[model samples]
Target: MPINLPNNQARDDVLAGRPALWLNPNLKQDGIWDTKLPVRPSRVSEAESNWMLIASLLEKCFPELKATGGKIESALIEVSPMREALGYSSSEFGRIFVKADNDLPVAGSIQARGGVYEVFMYAKALAESQGIISSEKEVDRLVSEEANALFSKHTIAVGSTGNLSLSVGIAARALGFQAVVHICSEAKDWKVDRLTRLGVKVVRHNADYSGAIDLARAQAEADINTYFIDNERSQTLFFGYSAAANELASQLSKAHITVDDNHPLFVYLPCGIGGAPGGASYGLKAIFGNAAHTFFVEPVQSPSALVHMMSGSSEQVSVYDAGMNNKTEADAIAVPRMSEFVAEVMKPLLSGVFTVVDDDLFRWLWIAQTQQSIRLEPSATAGFAGPKFIVNSPQGHAYLEQHGLREKIANATHVVWTTGGAFVPEEQFTKFMERGASLVKDS
Candidate 1:
């Protein structure tokens, strides 16, 4: 009788169809259950999890999300030989395969950690809920003078199906704004000619990626200084991707790594518009509150948040082949329906993983290019080969022997999160050749 959602007979047994998410129930291990709260602010500081208190809450509340890599606390650490070729025996995989920052600036897809703080805090909360006040002190004096407001008021709007809409159209042209991407004509005229060479304004829309977010919400309701920064239906893009789950819990506490709640942990995120695992499962359940085990991957021709979790309905997340509905080469975990906050927090805190084994994600991208040469494409090793293809299938080894995960899959030390990088340096030999086969189209 529990089902959830303020249970009026579990909201009429979820509109009379039932399956109100695994028929609710489990989640009571001893803590956090006050009718199952959304709580998470005691004594605070989940190491300011998604980092720099979300880049100082988009430079003091959305001053036109401009950037030339001004904030991001270290992101490259699969240290050394791709951490022994994804054997990943902890040591937080040496600060998660960090590079020398190899300067493409707003490039290396983790969608610039929440697409440049949800387009500078949702364009300063829609300019203080549309009153404006000298455009919110010229967006707080162009974000306390970090400058680069590229002749300012650039007018923000994003609709992405790839790398957070080309990393919020290069952070709205490094903060002066003026982006307009709205994808889904099966994008990739080389990422729409690299978002019109970062001047942005690429609008395609045959519909997929929710019909390029319904033409970017009808061009943000016919523009009033456009600010529709929806990376799948923003909670300000999970307050800017909870800063990559606060940089994976501050690099797993600088590799001291201690997972509690009966040693709980599991993350195989790769969902479209589900902003990098719904802000890394709300900052790892606000730091392991009920332990945590989030999974959300979809690519069997865009299952669309697994058909809106077997159909609970707020309708949106189906793929009717606008060109085989952006045929999953796994453009950084293709998204369509997002912001039901990952279907109400991955329904009872997580467990949904699917990967249509593109020959086991291009054989784990040529076994990370012959063990740690690190080529990684095939959607950057599908979140590190989606928990080693669900612990080697047969219903993922019988749900890992009814949930023990067979000694962490015989001590592989489970942590497969290589969620894409090395953008287009031969995108894993052109994600199985197309231009080499004359830009596909039997249609």
Candidate 2:
């Protein structure tokens, strides 16, 4: 399983089904990451716009967020036990907080951010166009029969491994839109069944995530009334994901955590098609400037984003370009290719990227639950290795020195964004736990 691809040979090895840990050498230290806000705000500002719609939708549709005053946010907890178990010193690595998006309400994943937002976007447009709701004052009427009737005429379609489909389907069904989730074969059966139980149409494909998306896109294009939530190239999804930064900023401020020159903030996000992590990184950089050091974690078999960014191209690229067949237990992040748009957006922003094998994912999953009571799906455990990877790698040490962050390591706060698994069936979770535990014992 050892990957030793050097330079141009990486493309060949990746195509042959080998895994790699690729670092971007064309990284630019431009002051863009430090900018308070991008000029157009298409990514950040529109995200705020969508956030308001999310609030409205939640207020009228989901009773849970309504109970919480229409706010959609998750916990940022300190897992000192897990941190210590990972051999990260509190004195040297500062505090470690797990942004528990895995336990998020409703769909229970990071996809709850963008996935639901995209659904709401399509719903809002349809409802407004049909005169179902006239103004902001009438937003609460989104759950009305009139709105539902208008929505039933159209459909919201998306291709997902699991979590994103749950969010999209849940949101779409809530507003009376016909939810169609085209899922890859690797997605969990429980997820598909759950969506089906909610009256969402579950279309199964034997191909991978990309194949499912391509099929869904084709189907949606054939019908004008169908809106495809394109995971690979959706600006709406990107904006929705970016809104997390504002929420995190408020949480950090409330906890009296300083994110500045002397106290850096490091975020490790697990990457799939790159929208979630890419948008999150962009927003963090916008908020904290250079003080925010963002890294993306990928499964070794599908380090698509890393490969794309390393190539430094505007054209599309796939992990298969280097011989990777894109197979991993982390189904949610098993995408073969990265989003070109997201890659371009994240090019100058990401501090580094690394890969963790499936064995490590299982080991970390067991460790997290047994030691910290933080149970995560296999894919969610991908970020757990981020801190260790950076601390041990030559590239990471050099990055710290280059950024003048060597001395500031003690004050740095590392946040591993847990992406999914709150609603995983007990049976399925137990199986994952058992597999992880067995792997840990063997290792």
Candidate 1 C-alpha lDDT tens digits along 1-443: 11113333323332432211212233333444343433343312432433443454354433433451236533445545645545654453222333222222355555666677667556555444544524534555434333433325547777766667777887667656778878876565677787788788887877666667777888787977777776655655664555455456666668665565435455656667675666666666666765455666556555455455544555443444112243666665655455565566545555554545444456556556555555444655556644444554354565555566555544222345555555655653665544213322221
Best by TM-score: 2
Q: RMSD to native for every prediction?
A: 21.5, 3.2
The residue-level lDDT of candidate 1 at 377 comes to: 49
* Best by the lDDT measure: 2
Per-residue error for 78 in candidate 2, Å, reads 0.9
Q: How far is candidate 2 from the true structure (C-alpha RMSD, Å)?
A: 3.2
Worst 10 residues of 1 by lDDT: 17-26
Against the unseen true structure, what C-alpha lDDT does each candidate score? Answer: 0.54, 0.80
Cα lDDT tens digits, model 2, 259-321, are 998999889999999989988888888788778888888887888887777766566767777
lDDT for 163 (candidate 1): 67
Q: Report the CA-based lDDT of candidate 1 relative to the real structure.
A: 0.54
